[model samples]
Target: MQETYRRSADSAKGRQRRAELLESVTRDLAEHGLVDFSLRRAARAAGTTHKVLLYYFADGDDLLAQALLRLRGQRVGNALQAVAALPSGTLGDRIRAIWPMLEADATGLRVIDQAIGLAMYDPARYAHLAREAAEQYLAPLTGLLPPEWSSARREEVANLLLATFRGFLMDWRTTSDTTRIESALEALARAMDREAADGP
Candidate 1:
């Protein structure tokens, strides 16, 4: 009985430590992107030892995968809230309100873009994360559409909207032109509204 109780207590502590470490890694990724992320640095950031970090995350790649998942969850939550608060108006209004939120966190967006590139080379690592991101981040936008639309049509439109945002980010990253990015998003918003109304 004592052994069992001790094991239970240890499990709880382990879970709590893992959570804290994951949170620290997430903040670092959001602030610094993933390119320069180091497991030793993350351990220091979490106020723990490298051994402890390794115990929780087998390696840097594992740590990165978990960080990406957590970041994806956060972005999804923000997107959902943004959509919920959108006033009743044309799709442009909704898009405009959300565009700034996405633009404000350029580091996070760039990390995701980098993840996409990494996934191309590592299909196994990329496939699960990609599915999670699409289901969590993309599905919410799809939910904003009318229910009358077919599943295939809804997915197509959602992909287009997501692609437009990503494309705008790529341009903004290179050019740093807020006006051009805003103009492109505005045009895409109008196109989305037209497609949503036209059916499929």
Candidate 2:
């Protein structure tokens, strides 16, 4: 009976170890990106073996998805908090305030691009992550609006801003053209002013 109790306790220990492995994996992704991710490499980074990593994650993609999700969550949460910290401003003002803060390091950008690639490659496996990402990024912005706006209206504003931000960021990444991106941001700023002045 005591041995069975010990066995159950061991399961909990296994879970804790798995969580620790995940943290290490996410750290590895943050520092080095996931370009060469494999069961053996990831296991080595986590200070474990391939068989042990397989015990925790079914495959490389599974591990990658989970690690990327964790990384995205941290970034999204920080952006949301930063947006909330700024003084009251037009929706556009708040949007502009957060733009510069969102620029990630080379490794961070790699994580973002690679994660998006993963979703593009297998939407079914990563669709939930993609959805969660949008939701988390959009969630905190709803509070930036005037209290007079309806919940639905606030949500619409968030959706539009989120879409615009992502599009501009993609353009910046693709063209390496900050001049054009800044112009676009100015346009967005004007549009935000108009939206704040004219309801809906």
Candidate 3:
């Protein structure tokens, strides 16, 4: 479900500048999130003008898509590192160890929360973001699975866990019911542990 955005510019210098701008934009998105996101603000942070941004991007949406991809990459990369540092154990145990790290990333969660809301209230504008994020965000976790796991099984577990995690976030977002969500996540962890024990 990943979406494509602006490609590398033809000139080497242009491509380098585009990449640099994209890095700044990604940082802006991480720090400020999607709420009231502005091209001008991103341009200011990147030490460029909005017109230059448009020169690189078709429009703000195009810029946003590319920025989201970068953010997703960083978030997934961080998760991979955190997961790696955990004491080796069953896949579920590793997952459990990393769950807190995932949750602790409030900036990442904030970005996804915006996408989740957009997916519901304004799908025309945001559905792709959510869908793409679900795919991109879960990819690293899938890669962490045992070598015996086929690509098919890896994708299956990744999508399941990603959707389940998002569902928990949605519930929390809507109702602020941490107790119930925690209970549900606990049940899910147990189920995952059992499944990992049984193996594919």
Candidate 4:
């Protein structure tokens, strides 16, 4: 009985440690970017041993992938929920309403930027994560669009939207230009509205 109890306690502790490690990794990637992040550094930042980090994550790539997934899921879920709550209106209104929420998730955006940079050299890893992000994050946004739009058009718009967002975020990180970001989004909203007015 005592052995079983000890085993259960150990399992709980392991779970807690893994969660802490993930949180630390998320913050580190957000703050420092992930160009040269090392697992040993993450372990030390988390106040844990390198072996412990390995126990939870296979390697730095695996840890980064999982961290990106977790951050994407949470932030995208919130953004989609906000978008859903917006009243039925022109696409511009919908897009504008959700911009603030997207802007607030700066950390999530940084994690995504890091993931994309890493994915360039590692197609297999990129494909795996791209699939997950598409299903969980991109699909929801596309689903919110008008049904008359074709699949190809929807895909194009989704890609453009994500690219625009990432570009603006990268600029914002360097320039801290909230006004420019807002103005750019405003232009996008107007353009999207014009496109909708023209109809399919």
Per-model TM values vs. the true structure: 0.80, 0.80, 0.82, 0.71
TM-score: model 1 vs. ground truth: 0.80
lDDT of 4 by residue, 1-200 (tens): 65564465369786787788898887777777776778888887788888767777777878877778777776777777887787677888877876676667556466675565556668765666656665666676687677798888888887777767667766876688999888999999898888777776
- Model 2, TM vs. native: 0.80
Give the lDDT of residue 199 in candidate 4.
70
lDDT of each: 0.74, 0.75, 0.76, 0.74
Error of 3 at 54 (Å): 1.0
Q: How many backbone clashes does candidate 4 have?
A: 0
Residue 193, model 4, lDDT = 89
> Per-residue alpha-carbon lDDT of model 2 for 102-157, expressed as tens digits?
66554464576556656668797767656666876776667767778888888898
Ranking by lDDT: 3, 2, 4, 1
User: Where does candidate 3 clash, by residue pair?
Assistant: none
Task: Give the Å error, residue 115, model 4.
Answer: 4.7
Candidate 3, poorest ten consecutive residues by summed lDDT: 1-10
| lDDT of model 3, residue 133 | 85
Clashing pairs in 4: none
Superposed Cα RMSD, model 2: 3.6
Model 1 per-residue lDDT at 193: 81
lDDT of 4: 0.74
